[model samples]
Target: MDGKRALYYAAIGIAVLIGVSIVVSVVSALLSLAWAIVSGIVSLAVLAGVVYVLYKTGAWLLGGDDADYSASDSVGGSRSASASTDAAAESRQDRLRRQYVEGQISEAEFERRIASELETEEPDDVDRKVADIEQELERER
Candidate 1:
């Protein structure tokens, strides 16, 4: 199931558990000690069960290779992926291009930077161009 459906089910389950607990507490208060103890135990068990169900269901809904999500791994993996996507470089290039257009850099300097970027061995010349542009823009500012 999707996240929204999971949330809806969780809300309903929580409401029902709370309602039962309230009813149990009220009934216990009206009963003898022995009965009150039994009622309290039952209420606790039910609440625990509800919590376990929610935990399991949530885990199932959020699909991943492993049940355990490592904080560092998730953060690092996405960060690396994004770094390779060229977004970072493109943003930089746009700024540099703007600077060049605004006469912050002489045409020869701009061409030189572009040429150097094109000659980079990184295999992602587009990204390098963007990075170069961004560098120029940042320097201009």
Candidate 2:
């Protein structure tokens, strides 16, 4: 009777496991179906957007607003962007000179700053190059 009871418990445990597995598999299948539907919707939306862009681009190449793009006509200004940057640099140099003449900055500081602006090379870069050359010369010796 003891052996029979043990066998019965083992059979019951297996039955419970089978039931739990069936429920889990059913839930997994439902989740997979939901994911497939959501992905299909997203894919359709992306495909539609791609088609619209292509159609508008082709229309623009032909120089007619056939597809009716929502974006405004122009993306750039008339003048080159670098023109303002160059003017700003010239103004800054003039200001630096004026400040130095007015005694607002020391002569040494003014000279160093002017060199930095004119050369566009960092002081550290100069130091690094000198170190490299010295190392090369030492290796040759």
Q: Please tell me which predicted candidate would have the highest TM-score against the true structure.
A: 2
Candidate 1 C-alpha error for residue 26, in Å: 41
- The estimated TM-scores of all candidates read 0.26, 0.45
Q: Model 1 scores what on Cα lDDT?
A: 0.60
Candidate 1: tens digits of C-alpha lDDT, residues 1-141: 699999999999999999999999988877878787898999999999999888876765563333343232221222244334555343444445656778898766876766664454355655644555455546666
- Residue-by-residue lDDT tens digits, candidate 2, 1-141: 999999999999999999999999999999999999999999999999999898888887553524332332222112233323444443454466557667798767766775666565446644543354344335534
Cα distance off (Å), candidate 2, residue 60? 1.4
lDDT of 2 at 19: 96
How much lDDT does candidate 2 score? 0.61
Write down the lDDT of every candidate, Cα atoms only: 0.60, 0.61
Candidate 2 C-alpha error for residue 57, in Å: 1.0
| Model 2 per-residue lDDT at 112 | 73
Count clashing pairs, candidate 2: 0
Off by over 4 Å in 2: 67-141
